[model samples]
Target: MDTVKIRNKDMLWDIAADLHFPPGFDSKKKHPAIISVHPIGSCKEQTSGNVYGEALAKAGFVVLVFDASFQGASGGEPRFIEDPAQRVEDIRRVTDYLVTLPYVDEARIGTIGVCGGGTYAINAAMTERRIKAVVSITGVNFGRLSREAFSGYNPLGALEAMAQQRTSEARGGEVRVDNYLPCSVEAGRKAGLTDIDVLEATDYYRSPRGEKPHGATSGLFSHRAAAIGWDAFYLAEVLLTQPLLVVIGDKPGGFGAYRDGQEIYGRAASKQKELVVVEGASHYDLYDKPEPVAEALEKVVPFFTKHL
Candidate 1:
């Protein structure tokens, strides 16, 4: 594995990434490649690089795991803004970088995204034809999640609040940011958040199990309006024609990854698509648990192997 910087042309910032080569890799021969995108509020070193990237590389593909622009080790000002459009473009930009490598087969390039990253990957593959295959693991359509959050009340009111905060920031108010999860599972329980996904996410991201200095799980509060207004599966019925794999846990949660996977499976225009529900698994369980992760990869590896 090699740490690398991918150039983001539109933002003029470098996307920090890790490039993993398969065992006995030969640069003289072109090999299929994959771009592993991290979850929102997470970095490459967590699931994208640490789990999927490493596993896929060992399975005989060149995998690149990257930090989205403005988060993690990537470069951007007004940090921690989770713009869905920019996140989609970041996948395309990573593809642009991958195709430049002599050892990469551009035609065989694929992508796998986890959590919010899965949604962005689906969004990106809609227009980015260079990506021949897509795998979305526990993908959450963030727009739907945001609008439905807090019991589906006052989405417009939340947008209005974001507008006010953005205006204040433009006028020199301090930029407001916050973590994506509670400090810990115990804290979340104390706060009355008993959702399995929420608690497991807190355990995975906020604990030593999956924690990294770059995986700060922070986001700009004002910029959330962008996500609330955007839909990751928009036009997927017409535009998403590539071979796709949607994986989700059986247990549903407030975050709605399971629903998103079901909707995408039904809506996508892909001639070849499959949805696998990992039994007894919740959203966060697919992120890192041994059995679930292995189960997911068993399907993912062959899907990409055949499609790419």
Candidate 2:
């Protein structure tokens, strides 16, 4: 568990990461590596990014769990912004750093993304062939998820608001940010957010389960402007050529919960792609729960071993 700083090729943000090495790791020998990416509005310390990084390290792969630039310990301005282009580039840049290491097998690298990170991972793999395998746990495309979740009800209205907000900001208004989840369980229930996924997300992110002070609860309005119009599913139909594994939950009554993973798995052009729905588990269950996390790693660890 060593903390390291990686500078992006653009020389703008200094990405902060935690590098994990397998027990008795020898720097003299090259080993396969996994780059673990965190979800939107979150950092390296809050979710399954670091957890899977540790698990894969123990499974004998070198792993890096890094905070995306501008989100965590990494350096960037106007904090909590989610720039899709920058995020994808961040993964490629991380891979660039990995290949520079003498102990890393540049030809055998993989990536695991949780939540929105999954979409970024897919996008990165599409253009950067350095990533040999792709694994996503309970993943979702943040752009599509946000748009569809609010469609028909408030999609048009929200778009109008964002446009107005951007215009105001350009004319010199105070910067405004909004939370994607309620600040607490009680707040969520009060706001009529009854879906178990939302409730569990609020509990996990806002509560002691996964909260970190440097990590933010809300995303910037500026960030939303960039994300709202983006679609991660773009170009996935043709350029995504790596072996892909998507692990999503299929709880008894959780119908729309796993649709994003299904869509991603469907669009991928990979000859070897699979969707493993974990029975009785909800989307948020895979974030931190031991049983589901273990089950997820059971599939992912081997996928990398076999492919990378």
Candidate 3:
């Protein structure tokens, strides 16, 4: 296993990535490689990112993992800004870096996007042709997420409202940001309705799950970005030719995302797309748990072995 910081000069943030591969793994032989992305508000230390990255490495894959811009050690001003467009671009940047390494097999590269990273991976797959096989684990439509959170309904109106809020913030004003936390713990509330969505987000983002709890408060008005993020359906409806895998769980919060991924998979031009749902897993459970995580690794190895 090896670790280093990679510099990215695209979009708002410069990336600092960590990569891991098998000891004495043959670089001359075209080997499978994975670019694993972290969940929203998560850094490279997020268990999902490294756990999966390390898992892939142990399985003989050269895995590259990194902190998303504005989140971890990656460089971006006004940190913790959650922009889907930039996040998607980050994956491509990592892919770009990976392709240049002598040890990497450019033709056999794959990607894994977890949580919000899942959406970014989908967007990257749509825009970046270099990605061969793509994995989306409990992904969501980022555009839909902002829309639902900001307004009760009316997607376009919500986007427009975001623009208005951006304008207001520019004018030296403030907007109430929702961090999704109950003022105090209550027993009956559904998990993750507070500052973030995933049930263990607080643990991963704010607790010691990672090396450092994010310095940025999960929510603050200073976090707004460009309106381009409002645009979803990164690519017009079409079949994605790359082999794709979708993993989800039966957790209450997991169903909707799995369904969304399925809908997109149906439109894929790629003949090799598969969906697997772990019956007892939750959205976060897939992030890091012995049983389901191994199952996820199991699903990917053969697929990449065959496709690559």
Candidate 4:
């Protein structure tokens, strides 16, 4: 594995990435490649690289796991921003870099997105034809999740607040950031956030189980408006024509990864698509739990093998 930096074309930021080569990798021969995208509030080292990226490389494919711009080790100002449009563009820019590599088979390039990264991957693949195959694992559509977060209450009220905050920051106000999950499981329980997914996310992200210095579970509040307005499956029925694989947990949490997986699987116009629901798994279970991760990769490795 080699640590590399990719230049984002639009923003000119350096996207920090880890390039993993397969065992006995040969530079003189072409090999299929996979771009493993980390979840929102997470970095390449957490799951995308340390888990799936490494596994996929051992399975005979080159894998590129990257930290999205503004998060992790990537170069960007106003750190921790999670702009949906920029996240989608990050995937495309990664593809741009991959295609330039002499050992990469550009036509066989594929992508795997975990949690919110799944949504971004699907969104990116809609217009980025270079991604021939897509795999979404426990993917959440942030737009729908945000709009319906509080039992369909006044979702726009937060949007209004975010808009105001963006303006304030533009005028030199202190930028505000918030944690994606509770700082700890006990804290989440105390805050009445007892959802299994919520608690597990806190445990995974906030504890040593999955914590990395760069995998900070925070995001700029002002930038959330972009995710609120973006839809991962928008026009997917017409434009998402590549072979797609969706691996999701059976448990439907407040984040709606399971629901979004089903919705996209039904909505995509892909001639070849499959949805694998891992029973007894929650949203966070697919993130790093051995059993669920193994199950997900069992399906994923074969799908990429056949498609990419």
Clashes of 4: 0
Report the number of the highest-lDDT candidate.
1
CA lDDT of every candidate: 0.91, 0.82, 0.68, 0.91
Q: Write the per-residue lDDT of candidate 3 for residues 222-294, one digit (tens) a residue.
A: 3443423454344525735688888887664622466666666666666778988887877767777789877
Each candidate structure's TM-score, on Cα atoms with residue i matched to residue i, is 0.98, 0.94, 0.83, 0.97
Model 1 regions lying over 4 Å from their true place: 8-10, 150-152
Model 3 clash count equals 9
Model 3 weakest 10-residue run by lDDT:
180-189
Separate clash counts for every candidate: 0, 0, 9, 0
lDDT of 2: 0.82
TM-score-superior candidate, 1 or 4: 1
Over the full model, what C-alpha lDDT does candidate 4 score relative to the true structure?
0.91
Candidate 1 yields a Cα-based lDDT of 0.91
How high is the lDDT of residue 9 in model 1? 57
lDDT of 4 by residue, 1-308 (tens): 99999884465679999999999999999999999999988999998888999999999999999999999999998899888898998998989999999999999999999999998999999999999999999999877876777224566898888889999999999999887787789988888887887788888988888999999878888888777777889999999999999999998888889889999999999999999999999998898899999999999999999998
Order of models, best lDDT first: 1, 4, 2, 3
Encode model 2's per-residue lDDT on 1-308: one tens digit a residue: 78899995576878998889999999999999999988877888766455787888999999988888778889888787888888888898889899998999999999989888887888889999999999988877766765666333466677788788878888998888877788799998998878787788788888888888766857777556566678877989999989999998886222243887888899999999989888778877888888888888889888999998
Cα RMSD to native, each candidate? 1.2, 2.0, 3.6, 1.4
User: 1 or 4, which is superior by lDDT?
Assistant: 1
